[model samples]
Target: MGRRTLVAVARPDGRYDCRIAHWGVGADPIAQSRPLGTGLTASAARTVIDATYDQLVVLDGAVRTYVVCWLDPTLSDLDDVVLARTADPDAFRRWWVERKDEACRALDSDGCDPATVRRALLTSLRNRASSVHCLDDASFLRGDR
Candidate 1:
């Protein structure tokens, strides 16, 4: 099996962050915290992060929900790996759905908004298509008398 890279998104203290790790023989997981950036709401950040990861795991803590996005790059996009909702998918979905309007509003606020970010994210997802092509070969040919 090839090396796999993993990315995680977690909210430790009411703030959104992301981490990345490599999965393979003797591979060490590299985790890091990501900034939600300015003008991005928690819901918007979650949505963006969710779209990047293959699986999400949610955990309940003292006063907040932890959203984790896990990815295996050997079978997925290395740069596109994500750790989105690591606790509750239902809650994350609801939060993202409700915040769509707010994200749009934010986009219109200062000529830039979360919707723009969302759209960019969508585009990135759409652009990551992979295709396979095969060429003619003579491996199937046998000697004829």
Candidate 2:
């Protein structure tokens, strides 16, 4: 099974380079506005993140925004979120690769797979979130889509 967690990297300093994106609640946890490596830098990342809030469009309050806040690396020895709800974030990436592989298995099929199209849809989302929400599901791999 694949697990999805809000991913982040630590700088030499105390601040973190966290990816800011929205993970929808209920049904499908994977929603629009997924991260596309924008938070790799602490300096310019914030400016880019602020743009998300400005561009946000709420459809009758159906969509909510959340940031992936990793557990502090300094407080613990673990490099990543030690007590993540599911598997490591890297596992999530691996799952995407596997899914794409399966989808491309058919010789008759052409164009992009679900994962590829998803990565392409990555966009800026509202940033400066105060907390993290944990809601992960691997249903898509079970042919849920």
lDDT of 1 by residue, 10-114 (tens): 344544343332222121222222223433334544444332333322222221222222222122333333223223444553444344445455556656644
Question: How does candidate 1 fare on TM-score?
Answer: 0.24
Model 2 — TM-score against the truth? 0.21
Local distance difference test scores for all models:
0.32, 0.30
Error of 2 at 71 (Å): 26
lDDT of 1: 0.32
The residue pairs found clashing in candidate 2 are: none
TM-score of each: 0.24, 0.21
Worst 10 residues of 1 by lDDT: 136-145
lDDT digits (tens) for residues 3-116 of candidate 2: 232323344553334433343233233353354453244443332332112111111113222322223212232222111122233443344345434444532265545444
